[model samples]
Target: MAVVAIDKKDLLAFVGKALDDGELARLVTDLGMPVEKITESEVQVDITPNRPDMFSAEGLGRAISSLAGIKTGLRNYSATDSGVSVSVERSVKKVRPYIAAAIARNVKMDDALVKSLVALQEKLHDTLGRRRRKVAIGFTDFNKLKPPFTYKAVKPDESPFIPLGQSEPWTPARILKELKQGQDYGYILEGHGQYPLICDSEGNVIALPPIITAEMVKITPSTRDVFIDVTGTSQHAVHECLKIICCALADRGAQIQSVNINYGKKTLTTPDLSPLKTMLPIRTVNKILGMDFTTEQIKEYLERMGHGVEIKEKGKLSVVSPTYRNDIFQEIDLAEDVAIAFGYNNFEPILPQFSSIGKRSPSDVRAGLIRDLMIGFGFTEVLAPYITNRATNFEKPMLGEHPAIHIKNPLTENFTMFRSWCIPSLLEILAASKDQKMPQKIFEVGHAAILVDGKPVEQEKLAAAICDPKTSFNEMRSIVEGVAYELGLKLEFAGLDSHPTFIPGRAVEIIMDGKPIGVFGEIHPQVLNNFGIEQPVTAFELKLA
Candidate 1:
């Protein structure tokens, strides 16, 4: 989601209506843009990243007006050919290949409109433009430029222009280092021997894009005609952005003109404002919405949402979305548009089929009994968090041969890994309570995820630790034996040589019914030192499975 801030005055003008804050919020929400916060002067709306057309005041205002009945049906915009041609050089194919340009004439300019244009360009660059990596936009004063432009790959020092926000001219290489916009977006062109450069017929630089535009031909409130160029590695993205800009300006009463894009021997005109037709499944819409809407009614709803709909009586709708819109693809998209136009608040709520039953299972009973048994053994039950770091989870290289599970993108390093064993947490509890008393005995019965066959397998275990100067391997073994006997399990212990977290000869594998359950041992000196615990620790863990 992207947040778009619109001046109330500008939005109201484009909407062709003056709305109170509450009404405006409700109206925009029904138009597929969720309102964030609306004041009397500004509206901050959460624009879905997919709806770049809805990311601007004019683009969304057009849709909103139609949905609110202030405006309706498809708006036919007119454009005249500017006869401007931008030649594509073969060297740019490996750099920034595609270039689609357009001219918007008779644009009614004002300070609010200028700011809106800037905001719309930034939103496109951040979202569908992919931070200018896949696409970048360039806007210039149309009257100041000559016809027949050239988009080519040039050496950084070969093309120099006064970049926007700067007074002096700068080379593309220097701009990447000295200019903040360049420094932030410089990585996109790293290691490239040549950079993308756009210029007019007389070789006056238009822009050094995916970076910054020229200051000489910048847009202002007085600029009536606007020239827009979209250059990138992807032809689709470049065309998509160009269409969005052209339509947004057209909504403001500007004429769109296509620019001839010369690619070696072939030529193509840009900013194709023609609507793309798609099939809308009426059956899927009815089934998903749980309401049978007639084709005419659905058409009305789609029209109100700014879409052109034609019903073929073939179980699907012949749908057409505006050129500025790129998010509509599947049946669900039409259903959503219909729902939005139908008003989400108007839908009747229905409760689910059945309520979930709340009851304790056998595992809960066993866990409760084990918890009580540990308390009965004079050990305090402690609870710990499930998320932990690597050092705390696997000091002994973990789960025999398998590594412990770790989070892919943790918000903080403190919660970077999953717990593979409970003994480490028990030791941490002792270290935190070291200042309290001479002897600290704690136990925990919790779930841990251990790696098995290269995948994390979650299992429940009962782990207890006695941290005291006199605690020994015998004490830990007796505690485990007593707990197993109380649980009605015949337990046997076999000597385990060379354990990582325990003394080599003092550890033994706890087995029951010929299956190894866990290990009990005197905590190794190195392990105790790693956790900063001075007391000798003896611990035992048992698999509840």
Candidate 2:
């Protein structure tokens, strides 16, 4: 979460209706903004990363004001045309293409406004810009730069130039090191064999994006106006950051100068905020909110939320969303507004309209049976993390497709991969317990992930492992067969010629009703050696259904 300081005057202007301390606290809590402290002049609200729009005091103020009925409108402030030109060279398209810039003119800079601008830039860079890789922002002393800037890629070892906050000039690579952003974030371009660089027409370095900016044009309190430039590999993200900065500055009463960007034959305006419309069936609103409001009532509610609602038919509503509200793409989202406006507490809490009671599925029943059988067999039931380390997941050399979900933004390498099978997890437990006893029997009934037809699906699975030196393939198979027999299931085996994680000749696939349900095999000597386990091991896994 990003903590933003709100000026008392600005806060009051945005949240028009005065709120008592308790009411203000409740509103902050409801909006997920934690009020760190309040003074006679200003209140500091902690804004979350996902809510980039709230990074500025104006945005937060507007949100609270609207909710409090102090304001009944939402509009993107119209931008003034500055006629600044930014040209995208063809050579940079494959490296880093997109660029957007906006000039904030006639703004009086003070400590409060300067700090707010800097804070907003850092927040957007970390959150929406994805730490500057997908989007990076550069603020220039508008008085220092010449108009019609150029954004393009340059050599990694390009000429040494001073970076923002640095006194000495350093090469691109050296600049990365001196700025402390090289080894950490400099690698984003290492794989591409090029680095994204920003410089003035005279070859003075302005920024080495995603790394550091030149110290020459850093924003300061003396700077009355600022030139903000965002460059990135992702056009959409770059444009979004542009809008974020533009809106935040507009809140401070700075006039926005739109810059025309040339991308081949197409020309686009920076900070573009065009209106978008989406239609929804009125019944959806009624069903979700349990409300019976007329179409006019719903329209009024949406309009109050900065949405332009039109009656499409007797039971359909068309919603025109301001360009900044990119989160509202679905009809149900508008329905939510209807619910909020209708008063969530006003709806009668009736029993489910349907008479039938919710019950577990047959698969759930089978899973319970498997759980009981495992416990009855003296096997201590264990549960493992659904997400597993990539090394454990793929290094095991398990046969069949790797099963596990992969996180897009993994906090660490240890949790990067999802578990496709339970065998590796059991093997991990066995490795840890080697010092405890000779024989360790454990069973786990949980979900395993797999990709089916390009979509991820999870299936309930049962896995059991015994780590006794005497454990063999037949012994594990008997336990597997016994569990199936107890569940009124017939099990048959087909020879498995080769399996990576199991002894090639000792593994067999378990078949039930002509469908392959599971596998039982002796742990391959190579697999055991990898985990530093000396005892012979056998493991089996069966699908719950």
Q: Whose TM-score is greatest here? A: 2
Candidate 1, residues 1-545: lDDT per residue as tens digits? 78999988888888888888888888987776788897878889998767788777898788878888888767665557778889988889888899998898898887777888889998888777767887899889999898788888888787788999888889999999889989999888888999989888889998888898899999887888899999887788788888888888888878889889999789888877778688888888998898889888898999997888887777778888777778777788879889989988889898766899889999999999999999999999999887888867775323243487887534344576888778888988887888878678899999889778897899899999999899998888889988988999899999997788888899999999999989999988888888888889999988898
- Cα error, residue 273 of model 2, in Å, equals 1.2
What TM-score against the true fold does each predicted structure earn?
Answer: 0.66, 0.77
lDDT tens readout by residue for model 2, 123-166: 77777666676678888888887767777777677767887767
RMSD per model, one decimal: 9.3, 5.3
Give Cα-based local distance difference scores for all models: 0.85, 0.76
Model 1 global lDDT (CA atoms, 0 to 1): 0.85
Q: Ten-residue segment with the worst summed lDDT in candidate 2? A: 396-405
